[model samples]
Target: MYIPELYKNENQEDIQNFIHQNGFAILVNQTDGKLWATHIPLVLDVNADGKQVLVGHISKLNPQGESFKADDSVLAIFSGAHSYISSSWYDHENVPTWNYLAVHVYGNVKIYTHEQAVNSLKKLVDKYEANSENPVRVEKLSEKTMREARGIIAFEIEITSIEAQKNYPKTEMIKTIKISFPN
Candidate 1:
């Protein structure tokens, strides 16, 4: 994520909100000399030590699951609204660009224990099902249904760094034109 100073967003509140709003993210890592990516729902969580972490699960059968080692680094990318801005829309000559909001989280992986995984799943379900007419609670699920949790790998990423970028053409043009067309 190349974040020019002008477009870089360092506000923790904004970044956290973006991740929460766009919980479904692309998790990327390398496994066995090859790159693998999985689109999964990741929720922001605070670890016991009070550090922010991203929590999610993937099928145990997914090869990417094997890539989750304590020392291994992974990237979670959350993307928001984006659109192409034609140069013709600008008042001055300019190249076409895209306006978008994105956050890149880099962290080390931590595979959760069965108990921890279950708790994570419960939190995830509770978060998303809050507004449903008939909300589904993980605790209310039958044993048979809960057993299915065994088939998944739940983990958390201990956030090492976060890079957020918000690129709007109008905002960028103000900075650009100031430098390009000085009075």
Candidate 2:
């Protein structure tokens, strides 16, 4: 994605925080020379090597799940608050524009085994259920449900590069004030 220098944001902490806040992400990849995308929730963690990792799963029946393989290039997108900006809001006339923030994470895909998938699912549940009065842990799942989960295709992405951008009106535009004097 093209990002102007003015809007470019490269803070590692900010990127990580955004991912955690918006765990649901869009996964984009190429399959059979065609573009494919999947929407899923991801669990973010840091490995011993201090590298960031993303884990998620897709239905085994999803064709895109089969298309992804280890070492393949992939992109995970996390979008933040966004809204339309009207030109009328500016002190001077200007074209309407959209103000928003987005982070693009590029990585190499790694398909995880059944056991790893189960662990990842538990981590996801733990993260989301942490605030509940009675947290529902993955271990509490019924045997039948666990069996069904085995049919899922779990994967991890080792983030190689990340690009974040925040788009908004220039400070001058937002601060501009109109003052009139009687002629």
Model 2 root mean square deviation, Cα atoms = 6.0
**Model 2 spans > 4 angstroms off:** 167-170, 175-183
Each model's backbone clash number? 0, 0
RMSD per model, one decimal? 5.3, 6.0
Q: What is candidate 1's lDDT per residue for 1-183, written digit by digit as tens?
A: 898788888889989988999999999999777888999999999999999999999999998888775236999999987766667666678897777789999998899999999999999999999999999999999999999999999999999999998756345443333222100
- Candidate 2 colliding pairs: none
Q: Under the 3 Å rule for N, CA and C atoms, how many clashes does model 1 have?
A: 0
Clash pairs of candidate 1? none
Error of 2 at 136 (Å): 0.9
TM-score of 1: 0.91
